[model samples]
Target: MNDHIAPPTAAPAPALQPVRAAGIATMTALALAGLGWAARGVWQIRLAMAGEPASGPPDQGGGVHRPLTSLEDSYHLVTTVSGFAAAVCAIAFLVWTGRVRDNARELSGTRPRYSGLWVYFGWVVPVVNLWFPRGIIADAYRASAPGERLPRSLNVWWGLWLIGMLSGVGLMYGDNTDEIIARAYAHVWQLLASDAAVVGAAVAGIFVVRAVTAVQERHLDEP
Candidate 1:
C-alpha cells in the first residue's frame, strides 16, 4: 500500500513566463527601427547626389566654418535620433529573448546550452558573437518545442545580421555629420547594402519571434 502512492508520475512542467507580450514588443521595435533605417538609406543616397559638403563649405575669411545647409542639418538630426533609437531597440530585444529563454527552460525542464548572461554579452563579444546569439535562440526554440524543425526565418535573420555587421556596411555611423557623409564617399554601395540587409533581417526576425512565441504558448498549454 505504501508503494502504491501514485507510482511516480512525470514531473510537472515548470511555470512559464508570458511570451506574447515580449514578442510583440520586440517585433514592433524591430519594425520601427527597420523602417527608420530604410528611410535613412534613401535620404543618404539623395543627399550624396545633391552634393553634401565634404569640408563644411568654404571656410569664412574670419576662420569660421559656414553653417550646414538645411538638408545636411536634417540628415544629422535624423541619423542621431535613429542611432539612439537603435540602442533602445537592442535593449528591448534582449529583454524579450531573455523572457522566451526563461520560459523555454521552464517548459522543457532542461538547461539552456548557454548561460543566462550570454543573452546580452553573446551579441557583443567578438568571435562568439558570430554564432552565440543565433544558437541561443535556436536552442530555446528546440527546448520549448522538441522534434519540430526550426523555422526558415531564423536562418534568414541570422544571415542578414551577419552580413550587415561584417561587411563594412557598419561604417555608416559616426560622431559627426561630416564624418558620416565622408565615410559614404567610396562605400555608398556597401552602406546601402547594409541597410537592405538590416531591413530584411528585421522582417525575418519578426517571423522568428512569432514562431517561437507561438510554439512556446502551445507547449505551455499541454496537459
Candidate 2:
C-alpha cells in the first residue's frame, strides 16, 4: 500500500478586472482627446494657409499680414497636449499588454515574454521610422490576437493611416512641389487626408482597447 501524498494545488491568480477597466478608460480618453486635437490642428492649419489672417498682434505696420494666428497657436498647444496624452496612454497599454502576455505565458507554464515600445516608436524616429512602425504595428496586432486572425477593418484603417502619414510628411517636409499650386490646393488636401487618418486611427484604437479589456477579463477569469 502506497502512503505517498499528492502536492497541494496552487491558488489561482487574482482577477485584474479593475485594472483592465481602468486601462480601457484611460486609453479611450487619451486616444479621443489626441485625435480630436490633431483634427482641430489640421483644420486650423488649412484655414490659415487659405489666407485667413492671424488673430494675434497685428503686423508691425498695422497691416494684417496673415502671420501664424492665435488659432494656430492654440492648435499647436492642443497637438502638444494630445501627443503627451497619447504617449501616456501608450505607456499604460504597454504595461497592460506586458502583464497580460506574462500572465498568459505563466499559465501555459512557459517563460514570460512581452513586446517592446520599439514596435510603436518605429513611426517617430526618422526615415526608417516612416514605414517600420507600420510593420511593427501589424506584428503587434498579430501577437495580441487570440487566434492569429486580426480584424480586416484594422488593415483598412492602418492602410489609410499609412497613406495619411506619408502624405502629411511629404507636405510638411518635401521640396519637389510647385509652390504656387501646392499653396493653393495641395496643402488643403494634405491636411484633410491627415485628419481623416487620425479619425480612422481613433476609431480603431477604441476597438483595440475594448479587445484588450476583453482579453484581460478572459485571462483573469481563467481557472
Candidate 3:
C-alpha cells in the first residue's frame, strides 16, 4: 500500500514583470526631479517678486529690464529638462499600467472595467480624464487587495494631480502683459499653487505606486 508515489506538485506562479517595476522606479525618480525643478522655479519667482535681484542684475530705470540671468536661466533649463522627463515618465507609466492591468486580470480571472488602451487614453480625453485614470488604478488596487478598503494615497495623488493640471492650464490664459512690472506679478499665485500641487502629487504618487506594486507582487506569490 505504501509503494504508490505522490504526483509532482505544480510550480508557483511567476512574479510580476521586472520591467513594470523598473518603469515605476524610473517614473518615481523623474517625478521627484520634476518636483525639485518646480520648487526651484517657485523659489525664483518668489525672489523676483520680493524686489530682489534673484541671482541677476537689479532692475534699472527706463522700463527696460536686463536679460534674465542665473536664476531665470537655470529655471528655464530645469523647466525644459523636466518637461522632457515628464514625457518619458508618462510613457513609462502607461506601459507599467498595462502590465499591472494584465497581471490583475490574470490573477482575478476576469477583465477589468476599462480596456487596456484606457490606461493611455484615459489621461488625455477631456472631462473623463479627471476620474478615468483614478478609476483604473482603483480597480487594479482592488483586484490586488480583494475586499480591503481602497488606499488613501490614490485619492490624494489624483486630487493633487488634478489641481496641478488645472492650475497649469490656467497659467496659459489670463492677463499676461509684456511690461516688466505686470509680468513680474502676473500669475505668481497660480504658479505657486501649481508648483505646490505638483510637489504634493509626486510625493503621494510614490506611495501609491509602492503600495500597488507590493500588493500585486504578493498576489502573484499566492498559492
Candidate 4:
C-alpha cells in the first residue's frame, strides 16, 4: 500500500505532438501571408511605374486604380493577422528550444548555457540580430544531435536570408532620391525580390528545424 503513494509523475512533459503541429501550421500560414504581401506590393509597384502613386488620395481623373479605402482596409487586416501569427510562432519556438536545452542539461548532468532570452536578443538587436539567431538555432540543433555535424540545408537557407536582408537594405536606403516616383517604383521592385527570398528561406528553415527538434525530443525519451 505504501508503494502506491510514490510521488506523482510530473505529467509527462506535454507531448511535442501538439507543439510540432502548431508550429507547422504557423509556418505554412506565415509563409503564405508573406507571399501574399509580396504579391500585393508587386501589383502596387507595377501601378506606380505606370505613373500612378504608390499610395495617396484617389485621383480625380477616374483612374482605373481601386479605391484607397478598400485597399487600406485589406492591407490592414492581412498585415495585422499575419504579423500576430508570426510573433506567436517566434515566441513558441523560443519556449520549445528552452525545453530542449533543459532536457539536455538533465540528461548530461551539466548546466544549460543558454535560454529563451538569448533567442529574443537575436531578433531585437539591429545588426548582430540577423546572423545571431541563425547561429543560435544551428548551435541548438547541433547540441541536440548525437554528433556536431549540422545539415548543409540549414546553412544554405540561413546564408540566403542574410544575403537577402543585406541586399534589401542596400536597395532601399543606398541612393539619392532625385529621380522622383519612377525611381521609387524601381526600388519597390528590388525590395520585393529581396523580401520574398528572405521570408521564403525563413519558412524553409522553420520546417526543417521543427522536424529535427521533434526527432530529438523522441530520442531523448528513450533510455
Q: TM-score: which candidate is best?
A: 1
Q: Which stretches of candidate 1 lie over 4 Å from their true place?
A: 1-10, 53-66, 173-176
Assess candidate 3 and give its TM-score to the true structure.
0.75
Residue pairs in candidate 3 whose N, alpha carbon or C atoms collide under 3 angstroms: none
Per-residue lDDT for 1-223 in model 1, tens only? 6876878788766788888788888888888878877877877787768764656433334656567677767877778777776777798899989988998888777788899999999987989999999998998999887899999999999999898787643365332555556545445676788878888888898899999989988866777
Ranking by lDDT: 1, 3, 4, 2
The lDDT leader among the candidates is 1
lDDT tens digits by residue: candidate 2, 1-223? 3558777899776433344755566567647655764655565455446553433222323543344455445554665566566667666655554454444444445432324554445556777664564454344444444466665655665676676567666553353222212332334655565656766766665666565456556655665
At residue 43, give the lDDT of candidate 1: 70
Candidate 3 lDDT score relative to the true structure: 0.68
Q: Kindly indicate the candidate among 3 and 4 with the higher lDDT.
A: 3
Against the hidden true structure, what lDDT does model 2 obtain? 0.53
Clashing pairs in 1: none
lDDT comparison, 2 vs 3, better candidate:
3
Off by over 4 Å in 3: 1-20, 23-27, 50-67, 172-184
In order of listing, the candidates' clash counts read 0, 0, 0, 0
